[model samples]
Structures are given as C-alpha cells and as structure tokens.
Target: MTTVIFVHGTGIRQREYNDTFEIIEQKIHAQRPDIKVAPCLWGALGAKFNENRASVPLEDGTLALSQGEEDADIVLWGQLYRDPLYELRLLSLKPIKSRNPFGEKPGDILQSRVASLTPTLELEANLQEAGIAEIFAQARDTVIRSQPYKGALLTVSESDLSEYYAAIARAIAAQAMFISELQEKFPPILTDAQLRDKVVELLTLALTEAKLGLGGWLLKPVLGLAQHGGTNYIRRNRVELTDKISPMPGDILLYQTRGEKIRQFIQEQIAQAEPPVVLLAHSLGGIACVDLLVQQQLSGVELLVTVGSQAPFLYEINALYSLEYGQLLPEHFPEWLNIYDLRDFLSYVGNKIFPERVQDVLVDSRQPFPRSHGAYWTNAKTWEAIISRLP
Candidate 1:
C-alpha cells in the first residue's frame, strides 16, 4: 500500500485539528482507497490564548460568530501576535560590543529595561483599555513628521500598519506589569500623556533596532494579529474538545520544541511503510518535511508534495532548521512538487529557491486571503496533482 503522510500547518486547534486533515484524507481516499493516509498533528502543542466572542457582520446583513471550525484564527493570531514579539525580543537581545556615551548600546539598554519589568494579567488588560494603538499612531506620526519628507507625503495604509500594531501590543503586554506598578506608585503625578510618551519611546526604539523596514513593520503586525486571534480561538475552545492536546508556547518557537516529535513520527512512518512513499505536507508541515529531507538527510520519500507552504520565504530569511546558509540541496532529495494559490499570502514559490528537482505549480483556489491558504486541501487541482504524482 502507498503510505500517504499528511502534515498540517500553523494555528490548528485540538478540537478541529484532526478534522482539518480528515477532510483532505477523505478526498484522497475517495479517489484512491488503496492509499494509506496518516496525519502528523503538531498544532496540539501550540500556545494557548483566551478567546473573546465578537459579532462579525456578514454580507447578508446578519451577524455571525467569527470563530469557525476551519477558521484561519491559528495562522492569523499565533504567527502574527507572537512572531513579531519574538523577532523584536531576539533583535534587541543580540550582543553588540559598541557602547554609547552611557556605556551601553542604545538598543540593548532599552530592551534590558523593558525585560526587567514584570507584566501582570490585570496590567495587560489596563494597557489594552488605555488605547495602545492610538499611542503608537501618534508616535509614528511624530517620527514621520521629523523625517526628511514631510508627514504629508508619508502615507501608510491601514493594512501596512498591522505589524506596528502587533509590535505595540506585544511591547505593551510584555511591559504591562511594570507600567501598572508605575501607575500605582505615582497615581497622583503620572499622567496619561507621560505614559503615552514612554510607550512611544519604547516602541520606536524597538522598531528602529529591529531594522524592520516600513514594509516589514506593516506586514509583521498584520500577520501577528491573525496569529493572536487564532491562538485565542484555540484557548477559548480548548475545554470543549474530547481529545486533550496540551498547550505549548511560541509560534515559530514551537517548531524548535515540537519539530523533533513530527520528524520522528514521519521517520517512523517511512521506516515501516513500503518504498516509494508519497508525503503531502501543508503550511509549516512543508517546512518540516524539507528540513527532514535536506537537513536530517532522511530518505525513502518517493514524491514530496508541499501545499500552501512558507518554506521558500522562511528559507530566504534563514529560518529553516536543516537548510542553512550556503548549503547545497541534498543529492538524494526526492522529486518535489509545490502547489500554491496566488491569493494565499503565506504560500510562496519554491522552484526558484530549490530548482534541482522541484516543480512549482500555481492554482486558483479563487478563495479570499486566509481562506485561500487552506483551500488547497479541497481543491480538485491539488488532489489531481497528488494522485498523478503517486507511484
């Protein structure tokens, strides 16, 4: 029997994780019952956050619960909310020998102070209540106004301001405990204006040191918000699931912590299965699969299919574990086919990046942004591509 291993992407909750893959498995089974399907479920180990219900207006002029079984909350909130925070923290923590007049690098000094502060749950809520977004916007405007180009010509779309919002949110959340203490310590003297100025200063410094260009700043927040939202949904519905999946911390960090579990699972599956195995990986799963083939040097995969994955982009940023800088593609790499939808912002082309034995195919899922990312599982073209390539 042909062992078909399925790998899922980010922000999947315990309640619906199996169903997400089962949907694809059922499709594949209906076409080829002879195939054996197994899923590598790692989303159960993702970070948990609280979910709050909000009514979203539909096109039909009715309201609906934003959280759905197949909703994009995992990708939207986990990656978006936590990724930027992780990046900023990493950037600020980088060791620098250069010292300013204060005998410390500006970035290091500021981050050290921010890190020293302890955040409480109550403080986090208070900061959120204080309108952190407005404080960030005002600071950003001031910074733009002081630039060479007048503020009139500096234009940033709402979409572009996503990362800034996320970064601001994270910074606030991280430092909330300290801010609350400060408020309590100086309730009579500390004013809202002073607090706002402090937040702007902290965020501006963090952004500048991170070297996130205007575009990066914008994109990070948008992605972070999605990740934050998705994680919250998972946390909210965590108790409702029959199968209990433990919560893990960090979006990208989860890869480091739980990647071995997935890798071992795939390895065990391949070892027991017959030769010419067909491995189908989606989203972060694709990244893990590539790392196994290229880095771990695992073999026996006949055909490797990656759908709607961020592998190419992640590699460019040097994020892939096995595929490091200046490394050549493995000689024993399996024949690879990458499928992506144009509207899926997270999906990217891998042929150019790994041209040795890779074929990049683009499909029109015709679904909206985040929906397009998950649509590949059910798309006729995706199934056709997988079936045609199976030996």
Candidate 2:
C-alpha cells in the first residue's frame, strides 16, 4: 500500500481543511483503494496554539459551563478587514481607483476599441466631438475620492494618496478614449430627442466599462492594504500573527519551516508508515514540504506532488529553507510532479526553474480566478496525473 501524506495550504479553517482532505481522499481511494491516505493535520496543531472560548448551546439546549473554541474556529477576527468599512477605505487609494476602472493597459484598450469601431472615420470624428474628453477626466477624478482628510481614517499616506489619484486619472483617460470610439457609431437616422437618449445610453455603457477595467488594477493594492492592516490588528490584540486562526500566507510559511510542531508531526508520521510515502502538498504546504526535505535532509519520500504552489516563485526569492541563494537542487531531492492552472495567479511553472527530476504539468481549470487555485482537487485531470505517477 502506498501511504499518501496530504499537506494543506494556508488560510484554511481546520474543519474546512479536514473536509477538503476527506473529499480528496475519497476520490483517490475510488481509483486506488490500496493507497492509504493520511492528513498531516499540521493546521490543527497550529490552531491549538491560539485557542479561545465562546458560550455555545449544547445538544440539550443549554449553554456549556466551560466552552472550548479553537482560534481557527473564529472566522470574524480572522477576517476582520473583510468588513465593508475597511474594504471601502482600502478601495479609496488612488492607484486602486484608476486600476479599478479598467483591467487592461492603454494599448489593449485602444486596440479593442479600434477593433469594434465602425469603418467610417467621419462618424468617429463626430463622436470625438461629443465632449467625451471632459466626461472621461471627470469620471477618472471621481474614481478615487479626493478628500485628504478621509485618508487619515484609512491610514493612507499623502504620497500614496497622490499616486493613487494619478493612477485613477490615467485609467479613466484610457477608458474614455476606448469608449469615445464606440460613441461615434451611434445611429445617424435618429431624431434630436432619440440622439440625446442614445448618447446617454452610450456614455453610461462607457463609464461602466471604464470602471470594470480599473477594478482589476485596484484589487492587488486593496488586498495588500487589507493584509497589512490585518496583521497589525492581530498583533495589537496581543496575538502572535502566526498563532491567529487566519494568518497571512507568508506567516504560515514561516511557521511551517521554523516551528517544531508541524515538522515533528510529519517526522512521526513518516517514521511509522511502512509503505513508500507519496507526499501531496498544496499551495503553501508545498513550500513547507520542500523546506523540510532540504533542512532535515529527509529520506524515504518516494514522490512529491505539488498543486497550485508558489514554490517556484518562492525559491527564486530565497524564501525556501535549506536552499541557499545560488545552490542547485540537492542530489537526494525526490522526483517531483507539479500541477497548476494558468488562471491561478499564485501558481507558476517549476520545471523551467528546476530542470532536474521535476516535471510541471499545466491543467485547464475553467474556474475563475481564486476559485481556480482551489479547483485542483476536484479536477479530473489533477487526480489522473497524481494516480498515474504513483509507484
């Protein structure tokens, strides 16, 4: 029997993580019953370090005298910044506003506009004469709220505010230009009243498109702001960021590498298993596994499977443990298989970076961004790849 040890990613609640593991185990067992799957359960150990308590009604419909709650069980404190107030503040950054209007670059926006434009340059010129330039500038300026006083509440610095507004302006300009081209294609047969209505409809559509484009750019910075604030909040509450239920991915990586609990658990599990170990790790878990293999010079790992991992990027940034700035892959490093979807921004190709004994497979996961990252377990291609590689 092949012993498959599963390691999960960061930011997962304990119960949710366990449920996911169970689902994956069931799928794997259906194909290969001889394979015995076991969860590393490092997340539970991580959660234990930051336990809390809350009153809860029992099965008898009475509150327990002493209640026990794992830090991981509390979702609110873990995701406080998800609140509307914080989100609105984060979205107030100028760069965020600009990027939020349009997701593509000016060139892409222009190309798309030109592609969709009517062949008549005269109509296009007339549309350009429709006062769109002024509207575009106004729309862009409004994307980011301009009150410097509001920044005090959001904790945005003056310089950042300026930069944010400038980005929003640029995005608005690009979007306006794109929309102006479409405005020219308005039906020439319309009467004065009809033309007024048509122009309103076109301008409204253009503004919406501009916002959509800018929204994509705004997302990253907004997320960064939330993460920074969230970390500070966790620290201020006398909670070690790592011990918090929903620690940042970077913090989770640090704990997995330097902390004793998770490493010890994996060591214990490996020592007792009789069959060759097939290690399956996802996202941050993959990074932790690589750290363990390198730092401990661990042996007996027959195969390593990583899905939706940032290992390649992390390695390039000198984040992985036991791997030095310029060191090559160790001779004892186990054969590895990496699975990733192109839509998952966190996932990257590993074989190009680590050529020896490593194979990277790109699987099409039709899910949207973020969802694509977590879709690997349920994806048929992912399972088939793992099962075929089993020794």
Candidate 3:
C-alpha cells in the first residue's frame, strides 16, 4: 500500500489546516482504503503573525492593509469579477424607498429590455453559448419573480425613468455575463477584472439593441461594484487584516531565509513513512518539498504532488534553495505532479519549464485566485489525478 504524505501551504492556521487535511484523509479512505495518509504539516514551524500588534497607520491614519493587501484586494475584485450576476442580485434585494405608479417601473423596463434581448442573445446565448442563454433566462426570471420587483412594478409612479432604466440595465448585464460559465466553455481570454469590464461593454450594446438605449453611463455602478465590496469587507475585517493577513509575508520570508529546519522536518517525515511514499505538498509546503527532494533522494518517496505551488517559478528565477537556474532537477527527484488553477495567479504550471519531468493538471475551482489557491484539496479532480498516480 502507498503512503500518501500531506503537506500544507502558507499562512494556514492549525484549524484551517486540520479541516483541509481531513478532507484528504476522507477522500483517500473512500477511494483506496488500503493506502495510509501521513502528515508533513510544517505550519507550526513556519512563520506566524501576532494578532495583538496594531497595524502601522498611514499618514492619513487609515490602517494600511497588510503587505498582502494588494493581493487581498485582487481577491475581493475576483469575487465581483467572476460573478456577473452579483451586482444585479444586490440591486434586486434593496428596499424600495420611493416609487411613482404614473412613472415607468424599473422592473417593467428590465422586463422589456430582456424581451428585446432574447432574440439577439438567442443567436449566442441560446446557440453558440447556451450557458449564457440559461443565465440570461434565469437572471430575468429571478428579477421579475422577486417581491421587490413586484412592489416596484406596483409602486413606481416617478417620471424620472433614468434611475429605473439604469438599474435595470446594470442588473441585466451583470446577470447575463455569467463569466464562470463562459470560462468553462472557452479558455479564459481575459483576467477576472478585464472580463468584468468587457462584459459591461458588451452589455451596453446588447441593451441598446434591445431598445432600452441604456448606455455605459447608466451601467456605471457595475464598475464600482468591486470597490464597494472591498470597502465593506475592509470595514468588517479590520482586525483580521492587521492581525492575521498582514503577517503572511512573515511566513514567506521565514521559509526563504530560515528554511533548513523546515526542510529537515519534511525529511524526517519521509524517513518515518512506510515504503512507496508520496510527498503531497501545497503552496510553500510544495516549495520545501522540492527543496528537500532536490538536495537528496529519500528512499521511500516515489511521487511529488504539488498543489498551487511556486516551486517551478522559483527555480526559473534561481531563487529555489536547492536548485540553481542552470541546473536540471537532480536525477533522484521523484516523478512530479503539479496541479494548478488558471484563475490562481500564485499557482504555476511546471510542464512548460520542466518539460516531460513534470505533469501539470488543471482543476476548475469556480473561484477566484485567493479562494482558488486554497480550494485545491476540495476539488474532486485534484484527487483523481493524484490517486491515478498512486502506487
């Protein structure tokens, strides 16, 4: 029976690690009951942040987000960017404060625009892109069915049809983009942020064709959706930013500088494992495993599975501890299985750089980068690939 050793990624606390690791344990149990799973968890030995430490205040005094703030911001953007329907959903849920029954209702205009949109979208959404058509139908159905839509339909009496039509257009566009569905059918041609912008542009044309005459100006609110989300998120998680997320750089720094102890610990785990071992590592843990396996071959290790790891990138830059820029992987290195998600910016493919030595497998987490990075273990395909290679 093969011994599947599990290694965790960076910035992971004990509880989070335990929950993710448990999923692996259970998945392996269901698939190959004879196999044994081991832990090479190195987070405790890696870097940590102090929650009590207050963040350094900016000159204006708003706490600067952790060094990882930009990355965190990208994650927030990813949330809004990936889900085209998010903006409309938020608008549909808002309380209707004022309505003019004499005036056109936003829902009425939305329904009309959707009706106009159907034939044009049918060409693409219904045929070339059936998923988009489904999303379009669902989005329209959801809004029209909402109590707010019903209330707005009844109560709207204002002549200022501007806001009503504007909101309607945005909601329709946001719901119609349904980016995740598009990505599954086609290779992601644009980043999440880029995709959101492109969809908005397309939405304006679609609405114009449908005769709503809703231009980019009316759909402007969609552009700020991510910013609005980030502002609210920061306000809610101020403590988490200063205390936990900010210290993530510490772990990266620690692994790069004080790495011997981390690598040694992994070696020890390998030594103790039964024969036919697999070094299953994630993120920084994958880096350490690559570093250790490069320095000297441990007898039992037969496979090196890395999920969302930066090892290949590090080696290309000559930053990996054990291997230099010009050197090929040591002859003793185990067969490598590197798994990555296209949405995960931190995850790299090794096949391009390492050729036949590495196998790069892609899994769709249906999530943006931040969530995608951590979501590997939960993706069924990640295990399917790993299990297929298990001895």
TM-score for each model: 0.50, 0.52, 0.56
Tens-digit lDDT track of model 3 for 1-391? 6898998888888888788878999998888999999877787887653543445333233554443334333443354446534434444444555765587666577457656664454344322232344455666566556554554444333343444444454454444544434556432323344544344445555554333332243244433543455554555456555556644577789989999999998888888888899988998889999999989878689999999999999989989889898788878899999999998989999988888999999999999868888888789999899889998
- Those runs of model 2 whose alpha carbons end farther than 4 Å from true positions after fitting are 47-245, 248-257
What ranking emerges by TM-score with the best candidate at the front? 3, 2, 1
Model 2, residue 79: C-alpha shift (Å): 22
RMSD of 2: 17.8
TM-score of 2: 0.52
Local accuracy of candidate 1 as per-residue lDDT tens digits, 1-391? 7878877666666556677767877987897888888766656545444332122112233333354322342343234233323434422332333334545344343334334433344443443545443233333333233221121112322233333433443434333323444445333112464454344344444433343222343345444554455544445454443123323224456776667766676677677777668878888778878888875555668888999888888877887787875566788888889998999998899877876668888888999997898888778888787788787
CA RMSD of all predictions: 17.7, 17.8, 11.2
Candidate 2 residues 168-222, lDDT tens each? 3233333344444456633331223333333433433432233212233344654
The per-prediction tally of clashing pairs is 18, 14, 8
